[model samples]
Target: MKKVAIQGGGGSNHEIAAKAYFETDNIATVECNSFEELFSTLKEDHSIYGIIAIENTLVGSILQNYTLLKDSGMVIIGEYKLRIKHQLLALPGERLEDIREVHSHPMALAQCSDFFKQYPHIKMISRDDTALSGKWIRDNQLKGMAAIAPALAAEKYNLDIIAKDIETNKRNFTRFLIISHKEKIALEDILTQQPINKSSLVFALPHAEGSLSKVLSILAFYNINLSKIQSLPVVGSEWEYLFYIDLVFEDYKRYQQSLNAIRPLTRNLKSLGEYHVGKRSFDTVSNDNKPLSEQKTF
Candidate 1:
């Protein structure tokens, strides 16, 4: 069985995304209590793969994960963008009206904030994992407790769905990165799955005016589209920053040329990955429905 490491329990979004990306149910989930533990597990077991939530539409980015991914030295084999739909789950016998306290991850709670406003009686408590909260309620047989988690958690933990699709916005989604040890996954193996058209990179440029602009100009000149770009500070380097970017392109040769052209302008240029961009998924609609992620170029 394929072993996938994720940051949470069986029914969490991380596991859900892994299943969708791998397109297989015949796998074992290695759940970790924290992201640190997840990376540590991968470090110890190179054969194990990891799925992580990098950014969410409702909020912004999970900044710490960028640092983790950068320092882990893991290869991004693939990516999956999951539409987040948080369900309210409770014990089998408990009704929504009977619930006095609702627990979930802080991010989930924030997404469903509008739903909670209608029921002032229920107090929102932030926990480490949404799926774990449901398990706790089920195992303890808590009557007055409910958990804001995915629908899969209800089935996995024997909880009933007290509510469904409680998120305030329908566009809420989280982008997950599938990563593995550099040696375990060959580039040819990933190529067989799909043609690569996207690349994620991180580089530090000289702290001078127009230095960053020059790199971007080179990419545009080569027909490369910028998908996402993020900047973080370089430790111990005063006022200096590290640039992390995701570039997408249709022409492979031009993409290669763009990288070579920018090498002279960038220092410590490293590729996070070069892989196929994932299809946009909005509430499981797939390709039939128009999704937002496909509409943007930069």
Candidate 2:
């Protein structure tokens, strides 16, 4: 049984993503309070894997996480995109009207801000983790308090979901990266188990005219699709930036050739990882706002 590090409680989205991406039921979780702890855990124990949420459709990129990945010596072995569905959960026998305060992570609160517009009397509070808030409410036997978290969190803490799908966007999704020590991500196994279709790269170019455009042209010539590109300012280098790009290609050989052709054109270019792209899939969790008893997994 493999032990994975997640940046939250047992029922967090990171745990959910780690389970789904690895497709294992026996794996155990080592919960970390922060991303820095997650990376350090992996550094100390090369055998342990990690899952970290990198971006969300509604919140955009987590810039700090991007910087962490660049500095950390972890390798991206795979990815998972989980549909984010926020449920308002409270103690059993408690209805929505009985709830006077709702607690959740700041991002969760922001995502479900529109839903609370109708309930002006209810106070909104931000906490460290969504699942932790639910656990706190349940363990403390707090009345008139609800938590905005995932259904899994409610189930874990034995709370009743009073409201379902409270997020402002129904199509909200978060992308998580499955990472591990470089040695643990064997290139041979990835090639055998999954076809490599996508890769992430970080590089900086000379401050010359058309430098970025020329790199884009080379990628296009090799039929590589640029799914995402983000630039972060380099430390101590005024105005210069490092470009991080996600490339998807149909042919692995072509992707290699493209890299070879463009290596000289780049400076300090780093191949983050090569793996199969992940798809966004909605889980069967009563999207129609049904009760917990009537809910089923999709």
Candidate 3:
């Protein structure tokens, strides 16, 4: 049996992906309430792998998860994308007009702000997970209270989907990364056989004129492509910043050459390791599709 640890609050999205990816009957799923709990769960259960949400199309990058990845010892072995469909669920027979209060995760609530605006009289309450809110509503049997979650959640908890596709954006997607205590030897071997498509690094440059520009120019000198760059505030140092960069190159040799060239331009440089961008296969599913009644819950 393969034991996998997953972020539990948001919904069964992470758990569903894990089950689908592994496709094994001998799988044990462990739920973590928060990022902290997820990491700790990974540490305590060395046999389990961690599946985490890294970025969302509507809400932008999950910055905190990036930081956690940078600081933690976990390795990013794989990734999968899941389309999010937010549903407004309430007790059976409850109408939209009967709902006076809505609850869901902060991100879910924010994503569906436009939907909630129609009912200005209703109070919006933020909870940890969309499914959790649905379960709470079901348990309490609150007639005027509803939850913004997945249609599967409403079905699992015996709630009614009063509204569907409530997210502000129609094309909502979330990228999830699979982390494991045991690094994937097969992935590394495959990456080494070919060229590394993406490389990630973290560095701190001296606060000086053109320091940042010089670092960027070094990559351009080697003709490396910069895919993404984000800056995070340095802890304990007021106003100081650390830049995290993702670069794509034609081959590993060129990537190494670029790294060697840029090393001298920055004060502190750390290679957060490199891995080929895995195939994004989940994007084929249409985001507009609603969950079927037989949807499985974690």
lDDT of 1 by residue, 127-157 (tens): 9999999999989999999999999899999
Compare the candidates by TM-score and give the number of the best one. 1
Candidate 1 Cα errors over 4 Å, as ranges:
233-236, 283-288, 291-295
Best by lDDT: 1
- Model 1 lDDT, full chain set: 0.88
Compose the digit string of candidate 2's lDDT tens values, residues 68-156: 88899988878888889899989988999999999989999999999999999999998988888898999999999999988988888
lDDT per residue as tens, model 3, 1-298: 7778877643467776676556554567787888888988887766778888888877778888887887887766656667777899999999999999999888888999998788899999988787888988888888899999877678778899999788888677887777776444343453455345666688887667888899888888887877668777677774377887877776678779888998987756876556555433344346534432122221
TM-score per model over all chains: 0.92, 0.89, 0.80
Assess the local accuracy of residue 219 in candidate 1 as a C-alpha lDDT between 0 and 100: 93
Clashing pairs in 2: 284-298
Question: Candidates 2 and 3: which is better by TM-score?
Answer: 2
* Poorest 10 consecutive residues by lDDT, candidate 2: 289-298
Ranking by lDDT: 1, 2, 3
Clashing pairs in 3: none
Q: Measured by TM-score, how close is model 3 to the native structure?
A: 0.80
